[model samples]
Target: MSKPLSPSSSYDLHPSVAYVQSILANLEARTGRTLEAWVALARAEGPSDGKARVVWLKAQGLGASQAGLVAQRAAAGPGHAFDDTPAGYLAAAPGYVEAQYGGKKAALHPLFERIVELARSLGPEVKICPCETIVPFYRNHVFAEVKPFASRLDLGLALGDPAAVADLSGRLKDTGGFRKKDRITHKLELTGVADLDLALAWLRRAYGRDLKA
Candidate 1:
């Protein structure tokens, strides 16, 4: 099941925020330093380059992933806060689909909006969240995502096995498949609302497989 949303985080209602909090909570025990401590060190009591900070963190015994997270958050600079809700994220996140659609891709907004409407109607158990750069629809786990581009939208579905869904080959793009992960194994290009209807059947299939009733 999706984890319960946090009530104390900067972006308490955002799944990403909760996920980040969980990661941070384990940082002190895993690396002997809290996120705050690492950020301060990244600042180096003055200022330091990202590569230099990562190197220093590595010297202090942190693995590549841990050091990278620390270096990234540190390099992000101060006051980098997440929105408290999906709506806010949609409105504020850089390169949000709506922003992309509203800007150079205005002609694509109606199509994306239609897709979102259909996705939101999936079921009561589903959560439609706007993450930093993507709109993810989740059941107990993420089953699909709608990623918009300057020209079109990429509809991602977490269908369990690619071979079993061969009938869907005409619409699937090879680029987004996660062969080893299996889930989110297909991506379909969406150019208009007419595309949503065709995608719904597979979306339901993905939801059925990835999300338990």
Candidate 2:
């Protein structure tokens, strides 16, 4: 597993966010240019199209991965979703969750909060990492995610082999499979607080599976 964001920091990060931060943190060391410099280069000289800019950066001597990262930052420009630094992104985490539950989805905030409470109760290691749309709950890995809809929420779980789990026989819908590279392999649609009991049960199972793995 990767190291925590900081020795004294209390926040837990989603794996994808962590990966991007890792790449950005090392950008200067690997390419001799900061992310700001790379974005400026891409905007000034590279193609305007994002994919084309990645190719252009690669041709200009950046590795494939670094080129892709630079292209993404350039395309997003200033005030990007994850921001320009790890600390900045971490600071904006709460706003991300608030955005997801705003407007027509505001009514679902209570349900999302309840789910978060249950997820945290599982263990202290359970980190609530909110992205633009979904809120992913991570244990050793991402065990579950809570995605809000205008009228309902989808609780996604990474249950290993849903077919073998009798308790989840018809209680969840398949989210493809790990073999197919889907981190969340099943989901339960929750319309209200009444649906939480079943959701909590399935969440516990998913968390336990990740714990053992």
Candidate 3:
């Protein structure tokens, strides 16, 4: 069987100010991934980068729970909505990986799992790509056989782990689902993102639309 991906993780500093800043700094230092650009939606100050950093610092200071609040606060102008579309636009996201071997995917598998679990628990389904690399590894794996959309985007794996189908009950939508449902597969699945993190982050971002319920 194909080996399983690594573990998952969450932020203790997520819901706090001081801690989150420190954590974000660490995230940036290790992977150079941060919400640095989000800080510019509101009124501009003298130093543009500093303004972005301060807005982020404030958001972190308020804590992870307050992140959405921070998003709202920063989006002060007309019809501002935190511009979440960037998350989907990986081709353009900062630190976004065009291929699998990116460090963020390798280092943060555990964190990705947590995000996936949260999204799956909230709503929508998860599908792990049943790629040539993965299918040979799993024996009892079940997939909802739909046509392939992307040349590289088909296949389903058990959500939490390749072996834990019953426990996690999740699938990654490789085909982007049929017309009624929209599937936004994470390209990192094939990339070198730690398998677990790639799966988790993909689930969170792909299924993010259904999270509200």
Candidate 4:
């Protein structure tokens, strides 16, 4: 028989596994069943996978959230939502994107919306996400970011060859070695949609450069 999962066993587990592990660590105290007990029940239900196993656990009398955690543990073993996967992180904080533009920051919502619209048009491969601090625009990797300030929005782009975009230095302004290793070597300030046309043009070129790289 496999050894039971313990909270201290989460050193190298996936984010989702580690996330579930924390809450379920004291499983028997709360749910009246140890982690091993839950998995044994799930396995007894016969061969299954993913949501199906979760559904089975729920029908077996575990509450929805607990069942979901047990099913995930049964399938993949120990870990937590902070493990590293983008989906895992998002699952842990579903309102992260909305919270970024809520309250006093609401004034910048439209600006981020416009940036997202343009980012989506880049291609099917583009992933616009709030990674760490900045909302990064990813094409294979982060090719751009939309960071809002209380006064203006800073649009960062990765155009690879700095010289090719150096002519815009007076307009776009060099990032002055911020995250120097990143392809996002330039930034433009935007106060409103009025700046969208020029920014979009720069992003289009940056997208091409990112794909080529």
lDDT of all predictions: 0.66, 0.79, 0.32, 0.67
Q: How accurate is candidate 2 locally (lDDT)?
A: 0.79
Candidate 3 residue-wise lDDT, 145-176, digit = tens: 11122223232332333222232324343333
In lDDT terms, how accurate is model 4? 0.67
The candidate with the higher TM-score, 1 or 2, is: 2
**Residue 123, candidate 4: C-alpha displacement in angstroms:** 1.4
lDDT of 4 by residue, 1-213 (tens): 123222122112223445555656666887788877888878777357878888787777777778877777677554434434444565543244556667777788777677777766767767655643457777766678877777778999876656666554366877854446756788889888788888888888878777544
RMSD for all candidates, in order, please.
Answer: 6.5, 5.4, 17.4, 16.2
Candidate 2 collision pairs: none
Counting clashing residue pairs in each candidate, in order, gives 1, 0, 27, 11
Residue 209 lDDT in candidate 4:
75
TM-score of 3: 0.18
Better of 1 and 2 by lDDT: 2
Model 4 RMSD in Å is: 16.2
Instruction: Give candidate 4's error at residue 12 in angstroms.
Output: 24
Stretches of candidate 3 above 4 Å error? 1-43, 46-83, 86-97, 102-124, 127-213
* Model 1, position 79: C-alpha lDDT score: 32
